[model samples]
Target chain A: MKYLLLALLPVVTQASEITTQRQEELIYLLHQDCGSCHGMTLKGGLGPALLPDILQNKPVEFLTATILFGRSGTPMPPWSFMLTESEAEWLAVYLKNPKHDEK
Target chain B: MLSLSLFAVEPRGTGDMGIVIERANGSILIIETTHNSQLYRVEGLGDLSHASAVFSRDERYAYVFGRDGGLSKIDILAGTLVKRVIQAGNSIGGAISQDGKIVAVSNYEPGGVKLFDSANLELLADVPAQYADNKQSKTVGLVDLPNQHFIYSLFEGNQIWLLDAHNPKQPVIRKFTDIGLQPYDAMVSNNGRFYIAGLFGEEGLALLDLWQLDKGVQQILPEYGKDDPKKPVYKMPHLEGWALTDDYALFPAVGHNEVLVADRHTWNLVKKIPVHGQPVFVIARPDGHQVWVNFAMPNNDTIQIIDTLNLTVIATKKPGKGVLHMEFTPRGEAVWLSVRDEDKIQIYGTEDGQLRAELPALKPSGIFFTARAHQSGL
Candidate 1:
């Protein structure tokens, strides 16, 4: 029953542990920094929404790639200089299941 | 301790007030600028995400424009909401007429400009932004011109429109269809002569002369980035916050850590000064001597002060993680900067760059003073 319950639990996972400092930076980058165009809550604005449900069909790798390289011909700018591949990977996973952290 | 003598003191009852937008909670901190302190807070201001406010000529009435198409008029003295109206689903910003009789809001949702009665927030006219065969384009880069005319750019359609609201009922509209593609932000000169539009779809910007509107749009810096490989553009720069010095204009270069200096009279590029990061606001001091510039995300921590005469980054300071906006005192003695991550607004000496005083705020972005009432192109 424990295994079954564990298997049935929603998958809210991160690729790696983000340090408290790094996590705080990412939260600010996601909430307040990215909030300028992506909406304060990551819903939608000049750019599209970054909500998990909105990006549910997309792969975590795609989200990480988008954050790293940014979409061309769009307002989304590359953050490869500011974020590492691993950190972006973590953000991708967190974004996919962002509800894990309640605002 | 910073000397209190250097601080700007509010001349008693001058009504020198401003609104600081706290985007996180959709609230604004009404501050008395002369005192450099908060007077009151108006909460639940409705989608202040990328918001702006313009003061009525009397400096008593404030027209707060929100991203969620909210138009709110608040009395600065009473710190009370005069009236709040949500005119559209999404909006960029707005402009109040020179005469201060009409208020125009620029929209992105339905793609048009709406004129309202400045007194009561009544819808005066709804001009649709239709272009390119049955398509409604998002309108942006809007500004109020003299003679009761409201001017704006059509983002998707690549055109500029001017609305004459002299009658306030039946308005005549003029369209400049060949201005440029994707004109993001525009600004009218402090003298209200030149209207320059920054383009994203192309390399250069489109220039319009309100005095020479009959000549159509003229292109300047037409080859700004055509030969060079463009860097990654983090956030599109808004020209509204750019600076215009005595004979030169300092504009943030698109997608690069550079400020493009141009000769105002000749309307030609002079030089590009490399800065810390992608420039956002390159606002000149009221004296038109030194210019202060802020950067876009990741590098937004530092602000570079540029010397207008020598054209060099004279001073650089990192106030906090995200330095959003800055507003100078009417005399340009002390400048107030909104340090977003630190949740504090720092008043720095414009000359020595000394930390004067810090006022606590809640995730602030834009800061506008009531003194804007006496200025142009706010």
Candidate 2:
């Protein structure tokens, strides 16, 4: 039980670390910065779409790694400098959800 | 008398009028420079996500190119959408001909350049960006030449094609192959003599002399910033905003925090001005006395002004976040900047660096003026 609690402790802390304000900033970055290459509506442009339907095949971990490390040959640059590992993970999860409106 | 005067039309000229793109929404704000105020918020332009505008010779009609391949003809005088057509699946931008008769759009999905009658938005010609194995390359950097000629670069095919639409329906094409890898965007010089394409996959720029087509395309600054370690580019630098003076031409160095200044005649690297961030738009004021530059991504909140005579950064100003674009008035007296994140348009005096006015907007991206009607590669 103590080991399980320790394991859950890290997860709880990690999830709580992303404040509501930081979440808003991340969403803004997703829509504006990432939206620059990927279409503002996430439909697709120079970069591929980040929509839930299109990104369903990509796992959360895979998308998180791509967000942090970036695709090497492509124009997508790494965001590890600005984004934390968990923040990128959160963005990947948010992108995979189908709640975003086209607008 | 009041009822009679209400129906009477106020005579006005469209030379002072311009369009500001509300990129998030498919709408445009019809604005006038004389008053620096919004005249109308014209909506229903589809998917203006990455839109650009080209004005007709009369400065009355604006040909708006949208990301969803929407070609909208806006009547600025009446503040209405005159006509619209889905010309392609996905499009980047467009250009108007020297005679202002032809309007050509560059596409990405089923990549090609479509020529239209600027008068009624009628299709005149279709030129595909076909390369090896019948694979269509994404066409970009479409700009007008002096004689109904349109030049554009291919991304996947790595080539630049010059289209002579003098005979609209059956246009003549001159292909320049193996120019470089991934010619992302291009621009014609202010005088329309030189067309330079910024290569995304490499460190050089491909230059074509419009007068000497026989000379072919030349690679300039192939080894610039070669010594510096490659930094990740947050946003692609727009060559459309490249600055050119009588003595020099200024371009944003990709993946580096520097702006490359080259001799206009020699095309040789003259100096590299280290800037605040990865430079996006390095634009010069109309008078050519000072150059204004904005950055991409995290450093986007700041704008740096460079003195053309000294080649030194004269001043740096923080004009709020998401400073997507800047446009100077016809004679360069004042410059207008679009602060996208703050949802406002900030106008500053070019000489004083003082805030002149502020107007409300919704996620503005590009601020274009009617003055571009007279310029070649706006």
Candidate 3:
């Protein structure tokens, strides 16, 4: 039973809900603006890799919190002032499974 | 049956040499205006997370400023790096003196400004930007003046500095402590006569007439943003406020999807042009007949063309997703625009708005040409 649950964990986790317009906007933000520092491919530049393969190991809750309240002492500015808690969580979940958005 | 052919020797002096920032790779893609194609790619400098370049007086040497405290002097003619220096932990941008002798860098980490010798990249003067109980603040909006002076604004300090690098031995620095509010970004006029800093803490912007520095700072557009309450500012808009054409100029209404046109002589509000999104770069065409604009993000893909005479948006085209920057040819005959996600730069004819050519690039951000060498406050 434990082995079966582990096998389904990847597909069970879903991206936070967002509107179509908001999703398009978020995807553009992730690629262009953030891509200015992070790699356009999300492979990492000044900021660390935000790719799904690297992000999978990190906790989704922690990632969502970081998106809202940016890392201090680094170049990342707090996005909560501009983005909502739900929106930040949506971005966090989407980053974990970037290819899922295409489907 | 075919005759032997040889290529033209690359000119030592500037014709159309320029650079495009490859942010993710810490390199620059070189191109000439004539070919509209890539000449070479120079890399291995340092961190270029956010980078900008300024050329020498002769337009032969290019000074590349990287965000990771790296400054490199590259020879455009030889296509090689002359010297490199790690100036700061993080830098926003830099400026070059009129005489081409001094180079100034604005830094974020351990906030301050550093002046370097244009020849050897040697440290000449160091001004630590400290204020509000000795807290070092990030510096922005650094521009060059006709004399040996360099002007920049501090974000946390809420101060604007005018440094006189004329006397290399002993530099004279002036601090304008009171400038209304938060000085975010700044730019000089086309002729290098006026230096204006955009204030984010409040509505108005602080303007300093470089011709008369002792006259002090004056406030302009005091209630620019006060009237609009619903406009949501996503990312901080770059405050290169006005695009001067003929006797008037155009300024973006920061967070709002509108642009304010004002008179150059009287400094009076002329018209407010509503755009599709929050405008970032409201640049005037060289011919002074049209203006081209791009947005911050989310709405960044749409590039709009505004008629200078009519003061209205003449045309709008969504070039691809992630349309980052647009650069006009020297005579305003063509425009080179970058679509970052597509990894391509499309050139269009200004007269017909028709796509002429497309060039491939690797995540390009800023497109700077050597022709800016002869200009001021790039």
Candidate 4:
């Protein structure tokens, strides 16, 4: 019974590690591309600053839609073709849990 | 012999010293300095060209000074240029003698001011403006003083040199030391009683009495705490625009967004009026009741009209983007402005500040007007 439990633990931990790595990759992408005009640290420059408090609780679908179709009358252009649906969803999830640094 | 050289461009056919306006399209418009005459369009060679100074006693001949030291002599009537003179230096600014005999060019480099014969393009004399103690003596301002002498502002050394131009072969230097920091630009008033020195990176304009150099004339500066060295004395931030009338001297502060008006007699700050962004050049109208300021910016270009009597901005006109330098015809009917970023020369009616016409694509940087009568041909 103990050997069986040990085998199951390794499989579980490996799956969780992969999922965390994917999330981190999405966060890095959002910071690099979206952060340019929106503010490097996602604060804001030519575009409105994106705060964690304001965006963290936002709906995933709403965030994804806004990224695909940029705000009008502003410099933000539509990035629908640049990011896949999955990639956009990943960013939405990352925005929700923006406090990765928080213990 | 007065001659007319009309280059296919339109000539309003009014004044003598034609105003040169470099347009946004990299073309130049040459209009009469005194009257609204035919506008001559000339081809230019540069990303953005400005006619810094224009020299011509008669309308038949006009010499234009550019930022990169590209000088061209244009025939007003024919509307075609006669010759192109390219010297080795960057000309910050320059002035021509009253007789149109000598042209003094100021260099931003350590190389001193160069005096050239206007007609033949001969180097009459090259006065070395380098400082012996320091290697960085950049000459910034050049103006014609009384007695055929030229006053040059040495920026790095913070001094002024009065050069005797009586003999073009050998020039004599009269040095006025320790004026201020970065003496960038200067101007001699209509009466020639005072020389207003625009000092960059320093507080106040250095008012030098042409008659007495020993007792430094009053420095028209803003009030600053004696103990606080960092506090600006007169917050006319960047020493960009310096102009003078018979009664007052106007210094525009680029950083502080204000214009400091000083009494020409007392050399004291009479008033400080708020103005637009980065006022680069100020021109006193012949009436002296108002002064026109060209606000320098990459975008949102405009000209601020200051009511000199009240010492305040009466109005602002958005002519175009990148309005660099401006000049009024001797007759004051039209005001020609060099639009650098737009690459065009814009003409405005002096009375109402209305856009009369737009000449596109002239890389004009510096400009001047000639009032002499037009001749048939050069």
Each candidate's chain A: what TM-score? 0.80, 0.81, 0.79, 0.65
lDDT of 4 by residue, B237-332 (tens): 223224556677787653455667777677776776767655667777656666888653322377888877667788888877656667776656
Q: Please write out the lDDT profile of model 4 over residues A54-100, one tens digit for every residue.
A: 78567777887877775553335555755666666656655655554
Query: Candidate order by DockQ, highest to lowest?
Result: 2, 1, 3, 4
lDDT of 2 at A4: 41
Model 1 chain B poorest 10 in a row by lDDT: B6-15
Model 3 docking grade = incorrect
Clashes of each: 1, 0, 0, 58
Instruction: Single out the weakest 10-residue window by summed lDDT for candidate 2 chain A.
Output: A1-10
Q: What value does the lDDT take at residue B311 in candidate 4?
A: 77
Per-residue lDDT for B1-378 in model 3, tens only? 123332355335565878888766778888877868888888886666557889998888889998777899998776788999998877778989989999899887668899999999999988899887779888888888777888899887778898888886467889988886667788889778877787766766788887887888888777865667635444455655248888777877766788778787766777779898888778887878888988866687898999998899999998887676777887778888878778888888999999989988877767878878777777
DockQ of each: 0.46, 0.53, 0.16, 0.02
Error (Å) of candidate 2 at residue B303 is: 0.3
Show the lowest summed lDDT stretch of 10 residues, model 4 chain B: B231-240
Q: Top model by DockQ, which number? A: 2
Residue-wise C-alpha lDDT for candidate 1, range A1-103, written one tens digit per residue: 4234323433323433556578667877787767777777775556776888999999988988999999877768788988888778767776786654564
Predicted structure with the largest lDDT when compared to the true one = 2
Q: Is the docking of candidate 2 incorrect, acceptable, medium or high quality?
A: medium
Write candidate 1's Cα lDDT for B57-121 as tens digits: 88888899988889999887767899999998778889888889888899887779999899999
Error of 1 at B269 (Å): 1.0
